[model samples]
Target: MMCGALYFTPIGRRDSCTPSEFARFENDEQKGSKGGRIHKNKKYGFKFVLLETRKGYSIIVGTWSGIAYQGENHERIESGPMITIRHPLWTKSDPRQDIPIMILTRAQAEIANDLSVSAAPFGPQEFSRNAKFVFALPPRFDYGDSTGTEEVREILRNHPLHPF
Candidate 1:
């Protein structure tokens, strides 16, 4: 199956967040895990929201909400779980398992291996571990792209598309 990679960009050290900000981030993470709504921009399509990474843990929360800035890596990893962490904006259920987890292809996995990037598949039984947050590397994109891909990359790099 065709897949894409979403590169993990560090925003800040978890310890660096103010208490309120950390609380809010934790709250948002919990809500998403409990089936809260993941936001999407109507005009610009989807905003790849910010997911957090802590200093020690290997599991990271994928906000599954937020905006993707221009030129940011926007490839979707295929082997990752597409489990819905949030309720659909207009529906009671979302059947997708691709949004909140990172699944890598064999080739991508090898690339990740070479790059020393970890791509661990959460075991089916561990889905009930009940951890609200975790951290691991998001996939990296390295394959060559077409002209259209370059155009999209250019668009992502340009910031007028950013609302904030």
Candidate 2:
């Protein structure tokens, strides 16, 4: 299963795949977890939306503060908020599981918000392509050697893709 698979683009690697390509690959795998639960349970303070693009389907995730509202033909997700959170590195041991961190991007947030509103009137389901939205991945800081920690921090702090 390719669910939650993380793709890393090493520094100075010109052949790295774009986020859109990765999303398409994951979508083609058809191993994505359903977003129904996340959509229904707003108490978690997280919002989810599923989008159908020309490449394939992509899932959008964001928080309430970042998303203003969602609806069919009427959706708005502010592209200004940045979410920094820790995520577990499955390849690592238990105690060090939470080393991986990420900052969500504006494009990703918009996609999530658009998908959420598009499905809101109907239910938790996929909606047709929204020309204004595109699939993207958040910038993730993975666990590496001690020497790379600073580099990761620098990337997390300076990457322009992340929302300000």
Candidate 3:
């Protein structure tokens, strides 16, 4: 699956100074799965979005770091801090056995509608198969103080995945 970031504005708000909210998952499959079951591990101070994908499901984990200004115009560029997809750390057993088939079917349909392609990209066989995938965000360059270096540093200090 392809992954990238997009800029979005909250509804009813239209001010340039208001930093655009950015969620880090977007591509052919995820464009449609805008909202999902969000699970927050408050004890760990982290949260994840449980998105239903065509084949099965995926989980995106991370938190929002801080805001930064971009380009010559110095436009706002806020990001979901250290976002990445996590696959089930499983072996031998099929993960689908645990999920209800009905949920998968609904999720698949949602993705198809989001795609809005003239022709269905996958056939019945593709839908029947079980699959899981993970994506890692590329390394980011520190924008120094412009991106709230001290804030990010503090967040990272307490980041759950800091060992990685």
Candidate 4:
């Protein structure tokens, strides 16, 4: 259970990340698990590409991000995640039941460690068992502004200036 720093961006249908960023991210993704080209270890689960600082573009893609309030017919069918993985960035705002699988870069994890929160760092042991390793943005990103912040807070809570 390597307590590492990880970065995550919801891969929306329209990825906001740039091509260079995307290419770099894609290369990293394959390193983790063989999503397409070649099959790596099942336990690796994207671990190979994700060990260091990684950038990812993902969409919650559950169709829920754009979902509006609906009737009973729209209820999600799944009872729960088939499994759980750990994320280093998650804090008290995050669930304890989930596993923080991704091994983040030292620079990335440093920011999380400084959040004035009582933190936990998982060791490398948990990697194979957990399944995913994410890289958090490096520190120096600022969270200082308070304008229109509520909207961002509803989800990311990332300060527009969050020095990443």
Candidate 5:
């Protein structure tokens, strides 16, 4: 299995969000737990999405508040997940885990690990979790007169790819 890192808006602090926003990821886990869980483990609580999948699937929510312009460090992590993904726009249903899956390669995972977003949604609550799509692009071109990988990065920096 492979893990992929994804980016969204930079998350602030947990206290900044209203109860409703936090419920997306929080309440579910809390209810599932045995105790009347109220608090969440800070480590598991992130403003970003992270997951690794070969066959099955799971949702990934990230909580990062940083800036990476030019799509250099598009995502911040070691390895991204190896799952199929789909973006919110592709499927017009409420954004949830039900979205399609995405297939991510090592290079693509690295790119996702190096992404940065403008601002995180569901503010005051660390970060909001969203459904992402598995992104796939056309075949690579071997044009005689064209920029290489770096230029390609610029071209598809804002790819609508996510893991399942």
Candidate 6:
């Protein structure tokens, strides 16, 4: 169980994450919520990608910049990327008890290693074991602003995990 910086987002659906929804998680990197409280991991300066195992997609949370809610007043606070990864646990409604996974680039893996988060380079076998599909965006691409799901699908259609 490695434990370094990771970006996180929520999964509201059953088996997939929309490009737009993923964009928000990818671009938005802040430490707490609207309720205002410091997350234990905030100090670690990590960002995490949130996903559902059922959705069959995994993302690597890289560097991010944005405002986040923190403290008792729910004040808007801006901060650099903080790092962390929550352990995989199935969503309540999903009876399979599947935990979501993350895929990292070489640099991201290094960062995760620094923070003690378990991470490995993106590979087909890793993808096969962790997800049915992958966003697989390179570090240079700003996936948060990407709205073209069809274009992405076209590119990834040949991938073994793609359902289509």
Which numbered prediction scores highest in lDDT against the true structure? Answer: 6
Of the candidates shown, which would achieve the greatest TM-score relative to the real structure? Answer: 6
- Residues 38-142 of candidate 6 have per-residue lDDT tens digits of 212122222332222212222323333222223344533222221222212324353232223333344443333334211334221233212222222322232
Candidate 4 C-alpha lDDT tens digits along 68-143: 1134444222111111122223234432222122233343233334332112232122212222332232222223
Q: For model 2, how does the per-residue alpha-carbon lDDT over 1-164 read when each residue is reduced to its tens digit?
A: 00111222222111243553322224222322542111121222232222111113222222222233333454344342222222222112322211121223435533443332221232112112123322233332233544335533443343212111
Error of 6 at 3 (Å): 10
- Tens digit per residue, CA lDDT, model 1, 2-81: 22223443322233534432222232222223332233233223222322221111222222211212234653332332
Lowest lDDT 10-residue stretch of candidate 5? 119-128
lDDT of 5 by residue, 7-68 (tens): 33312112354553322333322321222222232332322232211112223332222322
Query: Any idea what lDDT model 5 has?
Result: 0.28
Candidate 2 Cα outliers beyond 4 Å, as residue runs: 1-141, 162-164
Greater lDDT among 5 and 6 belongs to 6
- C-alpha RMSD (angstroms) for model 4: 19.5
**Can you tell me which runs of candidate 5 are displaced by over 4 Å?**
1-12, 24-27, 30-107, 112-164
Error of 6 at 83 (Å): 19
Q: What is the TM-score of each candidate against the true structure?
A: 0.20, 0.18, 0.20, 0.20, 0.19, 0.24
Estimate the overall C-alpha local distance difference test score of candidate 4: 0.26
Better of 4 and 5 by lDDT: 5
